[model samples]
Target: MNPVHDHRRLGRELDLFDTDPLMGAGLPYWLPDGAVVRHVLEEYVREVERAAGYRHVYSPVLGKRELYEISGHWDHYSDDMFPPMRLGGGEGEEVVLRPSLCPHHALIYRSRSHSYRELPLRIAELGGMYRSELSGVLGGLTRVRSIQLNDAHIFCTLEQVVEEARAALGLIRRAYDDLGIRASRYRLSLPGDGDGKYVPEPELWRRATALLEEVLDGVEYESVEGEAAFYGPKIDVQITDPAGRESTLSTVQIDFHQPERFDLHYIGPDGGKHRPVMVHRSIIGSVERLVAHLVEAHGGAFPVWLAPVQLVVLPVGDGQEERAHDVVRRAEARGVRAELSGPGHGTLGARVRAARLVPYQAVIGEREADAGCAAVRLRDGRRPGAVPVDELLERIGARDSDRGTELWAAA
Candidate 1:
């Protein structure tokens, strides 16, 4: 990885985010620019999940310790979890910050009974979760104590597992395609033979592993014997960064244990109750990690749709202030994230140089103002000349709408 494009450095240079030692390590403070990028990403993923028939919900970040105990996390994964906080003068139950959202989603699914017709119940949440990470390993947004996951659980019958898994895989593929990222390889993480980290149900493990293998039958994947979660087997989508360093960005996990542990059931068509298999999936994985990846992937120069500032309007002289403001207004009306740089802000040269931080810059001057246009300057040193205001707005609108990665890729 290029250290120059390291997210920690670019985050500071771009005024995107920061971390404070006063607030403890691994906690990020998102500045306005960074918040804009995060909001855009969250909304985009929300729409994607909505289109996929997923019901989004909000859940508390902390839950009673017994909840995780029933979900099997307390027995197998408590070290990574925050210590329990006792409430009510030591008379009440102990609560701990949840390490994941799957158990909470299982509770939501059990809140009401369902019929066999509603076999595939996809519940999603962009939920914030807290985990206890070692101070030595915490660096930038990639590894953090607090994480917001693009997590979802699909509760379906045994017969629907393959189809639901395929649908989940399709979502991951589509998301990666849109972001212009490719996975290096698929990894089927399974339980180790004698590792105490995994649950000890031979038959259940075998069935779940076989089901995942069948679902990914024709797909190419490497079997990772001891990397599975304590609850079940998972397919990890491993992405290789520009520097050739590989990391897991997404996952589709087959969980047969959580449902049974939580006693989640649905009424079958045969008038009998049956346990629904749970498929835990994440499209972009951790939102924070994805942001870090994108920042480094694009070197802090985000695309038109995801960029904090898509276009900067720079006034050549004080005389063009009114015209510059007018251009910003028009661009904003056209759904462009445009800003104006006036005389008092800096010199003309400095303003132009600052505009390099954004994708496109329009230098408005007396000549262009009189002609009802602005001189468009792209970051790649290409000048599209003084284009009409209407045409400029149209170009920007098209790029923003289409989520174009480069301003002049087509040109």
Candidate 2:
């Protein structure tokens, strides 16, 4: 049940995800199926974030070295970032690849001003983030030096902090439940009182931490010390795969500190300029890492909605190839990602075996072509059933809405 190893092997076996040390460790390639699976997740995140009032924004991949300096990453994680280089001529300024989605997002907020009514502003970005993760620590898609973050930043007034946190936690829960992954733990991460340098504002830390704790009351969680973000306490969800490996998939972080460092402010109803509290979050944290998790969690038999090929239409003989092709077109036209498989040089038995490898196989032949029906054999074979194209389309539509369900449709 080593998910890391399981995905590493399953990815290659399914011709989905790939990694090569020569190209540098931690950077994995998403083959056709892997890419499709990831695309589905990305689309899902985009829809959810948009509905949550998150405005999408794009920024440069590289930023001035001073950006990291102002964000304090230079001192905390400088070594974990790409080396900086001078841009333009030698006398020009230096720039480094952005390792996280925050510093740039902070700049986005700093780029504008707003009133108290607009205090709870959310900005989302599905952009690639770069980090200099040690090659030794690299593993398939689970750990990557370069990854895409389905990230968002929330800005709200002090009074709205708890509500904001609650909304974020709910979002994470929705994603976990939809994906069929067990909700391992949704906890309030607070710094230990023992940590000497934890904000000198003990009252602020106490009130903030307690607010988060109160929100989790009656909710499931087990607190852990020293796991809170250095900037603020947070609500984080950790997922435990079937193999028992734990990973943090999403978080709603309370940052009472970064806003000040970045000098972010908003106009209050009192006609006074007030600093807004900022919360950083990522529901699909790192898309690459989450894809890796899903690969192992479902053992490469992706749910119909997330499966790269929802159905592979196979011709029973050379004579039925065109009919199989027609079935493929019909499926794809219905917005189902499907393909046609041939008997090839192998016997019909071999072709059927290969077809089973796909999540769903449509065996089209005299029976299927004449009746205009498909033998929709599921990958696991636990649920074998025939579904007309329209029926399958209806099933696909039902799975598209993730609310309170897993990302991959239930088998």
Backbone clashes under 3 angstroms, per model: 0, 7
Q: Against the unseen true structure, what C-alpha lDDT does each candidate score?
A: 0.89, 0.77
lDDT of 1 by residue, 1-411 (tens): 688788888887888889888988999889999999889889888999999999999999999999999988898889899999999868888999999999999999999999989879999999999989999989888889999999999999999998999888999998877776677899999888734678888888899889899989889999988889999999999976567777888999988899989999999989999999999999999988888888888777777788899889988899999999999999888888999989898998898887786888888889999999889998778998998988888888888787766576454
In model 1, which regions exceed 4 Å deviation? 406-411
lDDT of 2: 0.77
The collision pairs in model 2 are 177-405, 178-405, 178-406, 178-407, 179-406, 179-407, 180-406
Worst 10 residues of 2 by lDDT: 400-409
Can you tell me which runs of candidate 2 are displaced by over 4 Å? 2-5, 192-204, 382-388, 392-411
